[model samples]
Target: MANSPQSKKRARQLVRRTTVNKARRSRIRTYLRKVEEAIASGDKNAASAALQAAQPELMRGVTKGVMHKNTAARKMSRLSARVKAIA
Candidate 1:
């Protein structure tokens, strides 16, 4: 119940921001899923390429405030390790 005009405006803005953030989060998840699929296929080359493609997207999520920097770094580390293991 946003009685104040300012509160109503804020609520509207929150809806818009939520939509944008949701899209960003979904995009990042899609990138991560690509890397996971490439890794699961056991093709080192493909996995490496997928990881490379996903790295920037993940970092972009961090920069956009959709995700944390440390979280992105941890994901990159684990994915790269798995990619390396896909020999």
Candidate 2:
């Protein structure tokens, strides 16, 4: 329970931020899923394109603090290598 006026306002702000962060995370997941789908479909061109689009989105997630930079980097590296392996 928020006792003071400032605490109440902070609580409200937290709720709003939580919603925004949730949406951001969902969006990032959607982008990643698209890449995964493309890869699974075994279309090298489409997979590459999806990976291109997803890379920036993943980096943006890192910049916005939704994900860690190294995590994003590792994801990118693995995805790129997989993409490379696709004929």
In terms of lDDT, the best-performing candidate is: 1
Which model scores highest in TM-score?
A: 1
Whole-model Cα lDDT per candidate? 0.93, 0.91
Candidate 1 on 1-87: residue-level lDDT in tens? 999999999999999999999999999899899999998989888889989899999999999999999999999999999998877
Q: lDDT for model 1, on a 0 to 1 scale?
A: 0.93
RMSD of each: 0.8, 1.0
Which tens-of-lDDT digit does each residue in 28-54 have in candidate 2? 899889888888888999999999999
